[model samples]
Target: MTDDTLEDFYDAIQDLGHPVLTAEELARALDCSQEEADRRLSELAGVGLVGRRDVERDPVVWYPKEWDQQARRERVVTFPNRREFVVSHPEQFTRARLSTFAHLIDTNGSGDALYRIREEDVWGAPYDDLADLLLALRRVTGERHESLEEWITRQWKRARQFVLRTHEDGYTVLEADSESLMGNVARQVLGEDQLHAPISDTESWVREGSEGEIKRLLYDEGYPVRDARDLDTGDPLEIELSLELREYQREWVERFTKQKAGVLVGPPGSGKTVAGMGAMAAVGGETLVLVPSRELAAQWRESLLESTSLSAAEIGEYHGGKKEIRPVTIATYQTAGMERHRRLFDERRWGLIIYDEAHHIPSPVFRRSADLQSKHRLGLSATPVRESDDEVEIFTLIGPPIGTDWSALFEAGYVMEPDVEIRYVPWRNEAAESEYASAVGHERRQVAASNPAKLDEIRRLLEAHAGEKTLIFVDWIDQGEAYAEDLEIPFLSGQTRYAKRERLLSEFRHGTREVLLVSRVGDEGIDLPAATVAIVASGLGGSRRQGSQRAGRTMRPVGGAQVYMLATRGTEEEEFVRDQLRHLQRKGVNVIEADAETA
Candidate 1:
């Protein structure tokens, strides 16, 4: 137990020239019982100072630390503690990083600075051919090699990779490194047998959402587990609200305060900003608000200054033209993902991250923003559903959604009453019809989506709704500009200057402009609470989501809402309305065949 005793034992062992000792023999030599000698051996081995053999009985020989090298070279080694090490020292490790997408592991001894293995190189091919390929690769790279499987297995372990699986639905098994609590839960809950071996040994498992839930439970039960990945606990959000929260908004803030993660989905104009700010106040630390666009970022800055006690001085903007990082920063998802902004995010200590229109963060470029460290992450969106990679990322990066719908908010008098209509206009233009029939795929869909026949319906809808502040969504910018020009109304598109778009939106909101033409840019996160009627003149190609988002423009609590979706029948345009508008129909939207109204 004493350092002197261990030193004497080491000297005696080497002096004996055959230091291996049975418990009884060692006990007699040390003038003690066999138990005492065994205890000494156990204590020495505990710190990796010795190795023991002959387990069946007490007659065991203890070897010094010199044998470890031999053991490693001759054994199937596994690093069970790799997960802990990687998490604590993420900087030191690289998961098979290359120019392309990174795999979780690199073949350590694969000689080349970049060690890569493709599926085509290793899988479903002849074993001889695979071996030859690996041998050749190793020879060229000058890496000492072994059996192909062994080399790959070594890389796999180093990668610390695992897949999270679900049984009921077809969800892609996310290939992630088990360097955080997220990864650990997937591995531990999926299969105990697989966990016992090197993680590479159990490359796949059948799991469910409940497995992820268990990790949350473990955290609640006081298990020492990390809840987030690569996040800094930013400044405590100093929440100063200018207005009081409604009952439901208060409930949302409460839930987020407790969990410190997850999404809040409420109908548009349901005061999600207030709820998010309330969460910030609850956390009371430095914060970063990420939005889908520069406009949304400005909107967040304005709302923060207007509603909360936080001043413009405290709030910073990270966007296309402006790059200021203060205690509370507002940034576009695009800007936040850029290399410089990413460094700023990583360098700063952030307590809270609130995503306005959180669904956007799940996109390919935007998802990288999730890698920014934060103590709390909150995503706000009316509909958080996505048909892309972000769908899964939303669940993992933030948490599940805590939401209320249009009807729920409507019942509470928090949102405007909605009037939904589908205006199916006949495709009467033979020339356009011929062009569409002759075209295929995206070209055909584009032709159908921007059909000239929809122009007549647009005119009729403007006539019918003539005076109400109106927002018209067009499928293409050229069409939007033409419609704006024809009607003498301003058009807003991606090319519209920020100041001009803001002025146009202001004029529309204040009744100076009766009608405004807009491209797809207005489909998300832009607030036009005053507009009661929206004419969806044309929509993105077959995207129900785009249609749904455009409809969201006016569904907020302002009363007397009428939404018109213009669709050209007997073409791919009709399919866009049908496929994209199905969910709206299911939600009690009064979809009518409105050729009569047009006539």
Candidate 2:
């Protein structure tokens, strides 16, 4: 295969949406002979533009030992088209586009002008020229916008009439109509034609072309673009193009890059994963990201590959299902524990270690993380503390918590702020309540918490939120199984097989299965952005950390969400609810309760 054919093969795979293609398929697509296709595929693979996997011996295949299966040697091939493009054109795009307008204003005008422009205006710029200039200015000096024209208009209108009276006996009144001056500026400068004309044509073209390009880019990159917005300054903003790093995320990354290790705490959907990815990018080294579950590990791997120039081969997964190790590895915490425990310090030098869902780090994992002598460590989680105060070990071993308040994220609209409604469902009979009370011990409490009575409430909640993706959190496996059986929906627990769990999670993510009953395993790391409702059927004792983590399972900032915490009135469950709120207090989460009717 010539170099041109190899390049054509890569481009063809990309244009075809990066589908996995065999040599014959590639040959047919490229209108070449099978032998030519094979040669080009080999050459492409040599340059790392494509990946090849032997399919004949795939353990996933049925009748793997069959004679026919042995006779038919096949290879599954995939092209890293997106990664190649990004690697070849890193200067063309960035995860975080610099604020060109703010930069220019700061460089050319007073710092006050930069401050005067609202974040909306700064982010909403429609002209590329303006955006580029602003970004350039910001690159030279740090500045940000705080207010927009609408804010200025409102302030001007409010200050339109000013009364003044002379101190003398005869009062001289003076009144100035600020509205007229503001109106003139509004008409002459801020008018629709004036403010928008500069970018009207260019913005329209960008809107039309960039959308298709972004969609194609994201699809070729193997991820979905959730939403994209165009700034008024003509800069197109694509969330899929880059993860938005929160202020705390930026600070944590900066600090962690300097220190050996540190913990990051924020509520769920507060951008922990975004921060971790950004930190990895900032470090510019071979980073390893460890999540808590296989599903989460895959999700993170996909997200990183899609959002950055990183290749599938560059990102590795070491979980129950996947056994691959690359420079940028993403593995389940459990799997990571096995690898770290098996290897000596001298075996590998991990430039950076990123722990997602850091709060779930078990005692052994905490010890292992502490023992690692990586150059940098970043612990990420919406909830960083365990129910037990033993979290001090994590802090001491991992590092300090460099985090911001969770409410701020809600205020910033970075995450959904739940309107929690507590419904006190009374026990059907005193006998049931007595039985529940009898099971007050630690182990029994979990079983009692998921009693049959709570199942009825869960059914009602599911019925009420039908058609919407809801995550039901139960305390015990039996309860999850019962719920799954009764509702005929997928259930996930510790006993779930790795491949089945991945399938179930994929269905849930794609809106195929709208409701899922899960054990405590769903409390961390997994990304269920489509889930907008959560039913806390049962919970462990008053561990607010658990409650918050469970709540965060559905707190992804997307569509509106409603969270319900069903508790049996006048029972231990009620006390557990109260205790959980107290735990959230430490993380600066304010639990506002409303009536059941409101729920």
Candidate 3:
């Protein structure tokens, strides 16, 4: 049939519930002559996509049935499985017949075969008819036929796929993962309360170990485990554990131990690492902490040792530079990205896993998180807002959010909040505005960098906050270099040597250096708590996450402090600042617009 006529026929079937359009009806719908409509219907019928069924009483009238049983038979025989049937008749029949029988079993709601069935019923057969079909199939195959035994064995495997017997009169869907599939099933079947009834020991054990291990542990503890795979592999090793958990941190441990996965979002220095350590202590098993950068990984190693009784030998570091996986290993995300290294982590299922700087989780790392059945999972970050959709993946694989409010940390005197100020500078001359405007795209950022108008303003802000520890945040290396050269302050960037970075950070930490200029490297996981003032010379286009990290640098409670963000008026920078402010506002950060005159 012609494409136009076929489209019309399909649309008519959808709208009118059948393709039985008379020539007269088609003529009116298509605005064509009756002869033309009759021609199209003839072509459609010839193609076997539609058929004419004669009415018993009306000799001239007929209805359309899209393809009768003969046409359907031809199509079904041409299917891939049908071709295989013609090539290997008996073997094909065995497999196809078994699959069909399995479907029949499922339709009847037989617990053994229910996993194969998707619909409520097949044809018009009632539940009892399914039982009769099973008996008939068994008789046709014969009691001694190997195919019959194979089919029954396959049914057993399929049955195990759906139902998981946890305890006496307690069951859960076997396919459930980090997000509870059985929990959802229970809500549909038994209502919300029964599904959410404080998770049992078996459920909690399953959250921590593999299904086999959970079954084995339960059987060993005399819980009448039926699954053979649950056989014990012997007692798991006991690892050293020590932690001082706050009330909130201890409560978080209880919830994590029960649920097995969750996130911890709190501002910088709110004890995310410490709380995660406490959860690991509760697990009392080997732990691995993953961080975004090597620096943060090292910082975590130190923090864990300082807060707990873990010895230097107990903790190992894994990153681009180091390669060691101790009982309690601390690894950089970069190392986790390595294929071979990731395999090692997968092979060794740590009891508890912690993600530091959790917002920076990449897609690959998030996928790897799924293969791990860690009994306890803890994601730590001051800003859990991710820059990509991978954030949603992390939320699914890592579990749910569990922690106290960031502002509550401030209220409880756990972390400090800084005073913030925003400064705007307009180009003083026509030549400067033209230069700034002409620098669009990549050059636009450079134009804003070397505006010369903001140099003195940056110096002025530094002068006002002089003698106090200060960090000048810049976007471009050229801008940072120029500022460092003109201001005679130490500078650090990706180009800086490791030794120089160590020295610069040390000098800043001590009282020797009053001012330091840095690029994005210093945005997060750096301990610059001594610095009380931050001058943001360039901003990362509307990224509230970046803004939070930049502002958080000076938020440490070394007495009250201030944050200054410099933006060029009548440029993309203004719109960028507005976008960033929107993100900060959601996090309870209010940005006030001011000028140099106010300072």
Candidate 4:
């Protein structure tokens, strides 16, 4: 049989939605004689491609050996126009191949996978050329898709059309593939703010302090700039990791070293910080780490001391509480971008700058930190999404996303996949309903989010979980305090003092405090202990990143991680909660919904 016949056989099975076929059925499918179909089946069986089985009182049947057992359990479906694929029970090979040119968006415990192809995915494909990416795509999808392939090829070319290079006079210049692109796209989009003057028809002298803006603007216009300018490596400071890196972490470090900038995106326990340290070790230069809060700044200092061959004196904390500039310093975004404190960072050259919780980098106030010049930039975030949908700026200003598939980590037992469920609780009384209904705008949402009946539901869940380590997340501080008082647990919020916050977090880590009421502050920044159960009693309105971060608090190597999202039923809160967890569902988390009374 020719290869076309073999491919037809597989296609027939998919069209039939089964694995087995008799000689008569095969003959009809192949448009050949029954005896010829039987001959082809025998030939395929001899080659171990198909298997033949005889029933007691029926004709012998033929089936592809590979699909005989997995026909119902494993399958791949594609949507070319949407550039998305869904795979059920995907094998390791399928995932590994897809990872080359696709981004894993969702998965579940049963190994159901959802992946989408984006321009960035194609631009940053880990291959030498388009042929390798196309081969991988064909292998994963079982065939080539002309439209999708054409789009990917165009994106691959766009990724290489623009380059930022260092001019001989020690200035940055933007180079385009053609004069038309430089003049029509780069110059018109960049204006005089980012471009000083045109050196050549295809080259423009870049303004001294507008590199980030230029990259961001070009990227918004569907062109990602390759930053290849000669940059300072800062003061030479020997650094080495005291611990070993996992295989994936080593790969991430290698990719960052080659690209010189990227965001390390992974689940909470996938060791992104460790990988950042690995990149620092690879770069071997002075470092600056920017975090979202003072607590995270302190945590970075501790992580560096524990994982790297660095002494306390060599590492500094430059937050509000402490101000010291050492070989390696950790500062909060607010302080680092301040006009007065900005000069402190400007005077010193940094070999590498690591942005912790980098999703904050795209905001107006925080974006100034992205302007800081460094030879290499590394960003760390569990979820790089934002409410404004400006997450593209995160990649444009920092670098492309680089990480392993979440399902792979879950399957390897490196991180536990949480069982997420959303429970809808009803109002406790008509008065409560009346108050919520009478409210207006934000007040309406606040009333719905703080429904009184949730307290009873929370108590019931606590009783069910018993002594397991748990966390209760709330959006409002008052609600958090109320929950804390009723449950007799400490409420950890932004209002909590630094000393008390540290003590509470330390107690939780050591199991002294089994349960704590956490506010928005715990959504990111401070490292909360891994718990067996996580409950979101109230959450910020429909933020996907917040939902993921809250669920990630329970994701660790240990099993039995459960996450419960509570929303006020018969109100807008239901929609908000659903929208919040939509991202997790796309990532393959099975989100079950139920009424509070039944749950």
Candidate 5:
């Protein structure tokens, strides 16, 4: 074969996403005979462009001669029984395809990725047509996985079996695709309080206050109900975004508008808050913004006033310190879920309800607010995973997962992917190791996490990255206080007075403050846009969400970002850092480990 033909053959195999392929597989992909493929491979190998190897199943496997050094093949291994897939060096297209029906679980900095395909992932798939979803699955895996496809088809059907629609008589009704589905699925799962009455064999009257419950129940039963009810879009308030949205942000808004509800899942500094505001402007109705803390509530108000045409009088904070319900109201999850405060929210008709830092929605206290009815629901989170693995509840309550993949945003310059490093520090002294060894249960983990040696490493990192805005995160309040004192920076925790907390965060945002030692309060809610470096001194016990969120503090569009996680050497802290960062690694973020002395 000519050199051009050989190059063409190489390109074709590369497009298949596998660096090595047997003659049979190569023939199928290239539409040539196996003998022809073998002959070509032999010739290519002779030219020092290809290598041939014998494996167990395949007598001969052909790959690029430089595959070991130059090829970053997208290697995908599927496990149907466990519903898991391990993909290494997944290309952009492969990742995009897998994302339609699979949940990314873990990854290493070496490009090995783990994904799980749950019933909810298929049910909440973005594809409107099953054929499209099936095509994507086939494209990603390079073959028809009959068992997986059958399961996905069933889930796709189940997700579409029931629809909550508005009846001409003005009441909400649950409509099923078939009478059998209505009886076997909706009627069987829903109580009389939820399904008020049977209007027809396939339609039933739904109670006013039971819409969220009905959806949740049906979802728990492996059937996702499509919500099409004419929900209340509260008093019309005209709003427009004063700032321009990036292309992906615009796509997110368009998707949310079509679905009327979804959680925006992207990395920090990808402008999910801006996208949430876009959804608000598209809704053109009163919006209720729910946050995990009073700090975020205040930030949301400020962002609205600055990014949108909303005035200070129009946006009100309805948390503990404030109780003003204006056109756009922001409330903390704790206060909004309270019985006394819930009535106020229930009384008003909100056109849009934005859940800021929505990963907390699965917790009992925060879950209650998710039941609030609104015409549009928009959830914003950089890391949506929770320790309980209650991600299903989050999607069911909010909507589907919507947004660009983290890797895509990082590559597109929409968000900066931080260089994450875990520095293993030795114990402060023999006494510290002794104390940790003597402790048991949770105390042991705490002792390891709060190792005093981390303070020296933190100081060194701060000095190396001097003049850059930084955030020091600690899970323990006492450790955070001590670190603050050592570093001579303010320590902001949950116990910090509201006024002081607000002032400190404001200073951090405006660059008046260079560094802040913060406790768990800085994990999710507060936005420190100017932070260029994040030093995580201690983290919650192996909480992947916490790890991702702390690192996210420095993820912005402009400038380089760095995350340094200090782990006590030869302790559980080492394992915790690995477990926590695996999530980011799977999203294509690089993570490296080093000794504190060198770091």
Candidate 6:
């Protein structure tokens, strides 16, 4: 009757070949209630002594650890038949690979990799000829890109749902590549024979917004991959400011806990970057924050320094001429995506990586940054929706996207609502209209969008919204210059020096200049929240993504924020705006028609 003898009871049950016992059976034997037996048995299992097995007839079968260990040895040592014998005990496969596998046959323990395959029939063939044999046997299984050794390793891992760490057993294990696992999937979806193309044409289809398509391909192929990631108690992220997350941001953060990597799709000024900072702190590991431009890289460093406990020494910028790596580093996608930069940072283990403006991630260069090892990743984007199907690669390379619509954020009082206006502009040269109508392709669209008449329209709006900051999005550098010179405002293009670009944007953000004209360079990464009024006088090859990105530039929650698009009445420029307006409408941006009376 002494309670001190429970360890003896546990040890006695753990004897090999002992019958499986229930709490009720054990309670009857020990003269105790089933609940008391259950509690004590749980303690034994917690200490790695007692274990459970669900037999065909029994819902829950409790057995000693010895029984579980013996059953596992049976799986590793035995096979379904002589056919699958080549899969595990491949000693007969003279050319077959030895993967510390021979060492696994005798035992199964904490560090051992478990394989559970239930095939009715397996191919018994030589290692070199196994593919053909398997093709004949399974009819569904093919050596699309994997060898017999790898296929068995991967398939067994899928059925077992356990990953094993590598050791110095002196057994060489060949690692698999993306082209092998994903190549077949890509070919099936795109109908393209060459899944891995030349560098010049590598990204023919795997462009942005392809996440959904990639998911379909994975499901169709029955790849059995369930996002090879899991989250745990991350390192405690310490910051200077105490915080309370909004309901939606909390939802995203909680989801991140479920999926170690995911995208947070809140609008600009909805604290997406702040949410990123929160994630960095939550994981409490060395963090890498990737952004699209050097300006964003600098802004991230500044924000962290101001809000987090990270000092200037702790937060480093790896962009442009400055390349510093620290506990918290912010690098431009272009800088970190390069092979040289990758070589420098790839070896370091990052606990968390935050991608700001994550829509840019599917690009060939940006995807390279994903090669670095990181346990947790948070991709932040207003819209992962892109004009190209290439974005299908984002899900595989990063993780699945979790999007909280900008419209929802707007409704929740998290981001500013847009005041959209559709305006019409006459041709800068009326005679050019005849040629533009006759012209085809990108040339005609450019001429129609770059109307010099739009400069006067910008002037009138500047006069109306006198004190409000204005951003004029021209189609090209020369047009931006002509308008900036005529209106006595600043102008920016890709040609602007990095230092000068920074200075010009600083002046605009701080009100040193109320109005500045910039070409497409302003669309992607530059944040001009002070500019409540944006005039879109040019376009980016009818790309709806470019249009939405341009609208996002003025999304910094400034009062009276308005976005106005001016298109030539009858040209393709009008069609482009109409197309972009439809895309924005789907994103819940309000579009209104404007005329002289309204102006």
Q: Which runs of model 4 end up more than 4 angstroms from their true locations?
A: 1-68, 72-82, 105-110, 138-147
- Model 5 worst lDDT run, 10 consecutive residues: 1-10
Ranked by TM-score, the better of candidates 1 and 4 is: 4
lDDT of the candidates, in the order given = 0.63, 0.56, 0.60, 0.87, 0.85, 0.62
Q: Of 3 and 5, which scores higher on lDDT?
A: 5
Models 1 onward score TM values of 0.62, 0.56, 0.60, 0.87, 0.83, 0.63
Name the regions of candidate 3 deviating beyond 4 angstroms: 1-246, 362-370, 597-599
Candidate maximizing TM-score: 4
Question: Which of the two candidates, 2 or 4, achieves a greater TM-score against the reference?
Answer: 4
- lDDT tens digits, residue span 1-599, model 2: 45676566656667666445566766777888978877777766666555566676431111112334333332211112210111111111111222212211111111111112333223223233344534543343334323333342343333223222222343222222354522343223223322222222112112221222322232232222222221111111112236566665786677566544567766777777777777777767677677766777778878887777777767778777877767776766665556553363225566677877677654665344444435566787665556565664454444545654554455567777675666677665567767776774675566457556676777777778889888888877877787888888788887898779888889998878888888887876567777889888887464667888777776776667787888766666677787775545433344555433222
TM-score attained by model 2: 0.56
Cα lDDT of model 5 by residue, 2-59, tens digit:
5854776677677778777787777786688989878878888887888888889879
Q: In candidate 4, what are the lDDT values of residues 1-599, reduced to their tens digit?
A: 45766787787778888767788887888789999988887888888888889987657987878765665576899999999999988887887778767888777666677889998888777677888788888888888899999999999999999999999999999999999999899888988898889999999999988999998888889998988889999998888899999888998898889878889988888889889999999999999999989988888888999999999999999989999999899999999999999999988999999999999999988999999999899999988888898998998888888887777777788888899989989889999999998999999999988998999999999999989999999889889888888889999989998899999999988888888889888888877756889999887485899999999998887777899999999999889988888887776667899888833
Of candidates 6 and 2, the better by lDDT: 6
Question: Which stretches of candidate 6 lie above 4 Å from their native place?
Answer: 1-224, 227-244, 595-599
Which stretches of model 1 miss by more than 4 angstroms?
1-232, 540-542, 586-588, 596-599
Best by lDDT: 4
Residue-by-residue lDDT tens digits, candidate 6, 375-429: 7878887666667865545544565555454554554566777777888776666
- Candidate 6: lDDT over CA atoms? 0.62
User: How far in Å is the alpha carbon of 138 misplaced in model 5?
Assistant: 5.9
Which consecutive 10 residues in model 4 have the weakest lDDT in total? 66-75
